[model samples]
Target: MLKLTDMTLHYGHSQILNGISMEARQGEVTCVMGTNGVGKTSLMKAISGTHPRSGGKLELNGEQLGVLPAHRMAWKGVAYVPQGREIFPLLTVRENLETGFSCLPVSEHFVPDEVFDLFPVLKQMQNRRGGDLSGGQQQQLAIARALITKPNLLLLDEPTEGIQPNIIQQIGEVIRHLRTTSRMAIVLVEQYFDFAYDLADRLVVLRRGEVMIKGTRDNLTRDQVLQAVSV
Candidate 1:
């Protein structure tokens, strides 16, 4: 559902992603794993238009995409749950979710029941301030807000980072359920090896902003991926 060819990104002048190329197909979890500062998060931002790529082609669902901003990308069916969760601390949980409605028609402004079904805690705390929630709850809120958009491509940057073990497992189960639906392509930027490995259909390892190793789960061994990311 998403493709990047020789993609590059820069913060002023220092390039973070160097000629990176990869594809994320519908109904598949394409896990991008690497050590810190390897541009895993930067790649996610580039794909989701939170940060525009400096060079190369970006195509989503077959159409070539230009350097559009984040909201525009959302309109194009891309949802990004960034590394920090980035929830509005001052806003209520419901209000935070309502923000996603900006990209949708007014008729579809309401949150889906399935969203609550996915994270029942959110439904219970709809009126709670975002900052008041625990880290794990906020993470769930971040993912839930993204799902509100009904995106074709979901860009998740480190959904497990700093989350509790139980919450991490819940997030994994949600990812698994999403994959089973064959609804959208998932590009997960993750550091937790076991969590990522268990859910990844395809693995794309990045080293210093370029793809170091990439293949299906059947083609790449666990030790190979672990070594590549560790190095």
Candidate 2:
């Protein structure tokens, strides 16, 4: 549902992404695997409109990005769960989720039940401050907040980072469930090969901001993916 063709991005004078090309299909997870500092996050930033692309094209369901800012992208069915799970430390969970309402009409400002079903802890901690939650809970809160927008393209960056093993398993299950139950396309950036391999229908590996390897699960093995991602 999302496609990036020869995409490139720059930070001031330093170019971070180099002709990166990949695609994420509806009802599937396209995991971007790479070592640290390989521009995986930069690629995501380019797609999500947080950092605009310097060159190439970004199209969602054949619709090219046309001068859309980050808020505008969120309004156009793109929801991003950033690497650090940037939840508002001071806001209550409910209030934090309400922030997503900025992009929605008044009639669609409420959180969906599916978010509670996906992470019950978020519902339970509705009135608690986001900063008080543990790392795993914070991750769940971040994902929950993103879902409040009802997006079609979900961009998740390093979801398993710093999360507990059990929470990681839960997150993986949630990702798989979303792929099967919802039509939303997912772009996952994960350094955890085992987790990404298990859930990824397609894998895209990056090195120095370039596509090093990419294919479907039926064509690539865990070892091959692992080797490609190794620094």
Candidate 3:
């Protein structure tokens, strides 16, 4: 459902992504894996419009989305759960979820019951401030907040980073459910090899701002991919 052709990006004259081309299909997890400084998060920023591409094309559902900003992208069904979780420290859990209402119509302002079902802990701490939650809870809140936007294209950058093992497993299940149940086109940028490999239907390995390996999981083994990303 998402197509990127020759996608390029730069920061202050230094090119981060060069001639990158990839596609993410509905009901599949397209995991982007790489070593540090390989432009994984930079690619996510470009797709989510947090940073504009230097040159290239971004198309969603056959419609070319030419250099739109984050808010515009969100309206077009792109939800980004960035690397740091970025939840509001002072806001209550419910309030943070409600923050997504800015992208929705006024009639759809209420929080959906399924959100609480996905993270039952969030239901119990509806009034607790975001900063009070544990790291894992915060991560779940971040994903739930993104889901509140009802995105067709979900860009998740390193959801497993710094998360506890059990929570990481929960997050994996959530991602699996999202792809299978809703057919969302998920583009995940992950450094955790096992986590990415298990969930990825297709994998794209990037090195120095370019694709080094791109193929289905059945065609690539963990050792092969691990060797490529190992610096």
Q: Please, what is the TM-score per model?
A: 0.98, 0.97, 0.98
Candidate 3, residues 1-231: lDDT per residue as tens digits? 999999999999899999999999999999999999999999999999999999999999889989999999999999999999999989999999999999999999988998988899999999999999999999999999999998899999999889999999999999998988996899999999999999999999999999999888899998988888785
> Residue 223 of candidate 1: its Cα lDDT?
98
Clashing pairs in 2: none
Highest lDDT among the candidates is held by which one? 1
- The residue pairs in collision within model 3 are none
Please give the CA lDDT of all the candidate structures: 0.95, 0.91, 0.94
Q: After best superposition, candidate 3 residue 51: deviation in angstroms?
A: 0.5
| Superior candidate under lDDT, 1 versus 3 | 1
| TM accuracy, model 1 | 0.98
List ranges where model 3 is wrong by over 4 Å.
Answer: none
Off by over 4 Å in 1: none
Model 2 lDDT tens row, 99-145: 98887889998998888999999899999999999999999988888
Pairs with steric clashes in candidate 1? none
Please give the lDDT score for candidate 3: 0.94
Candidate 1 lDDT, 136-216, residue by residue in tens:
999999999999999999999999889999999999999999999748999998999999999999999999999999999
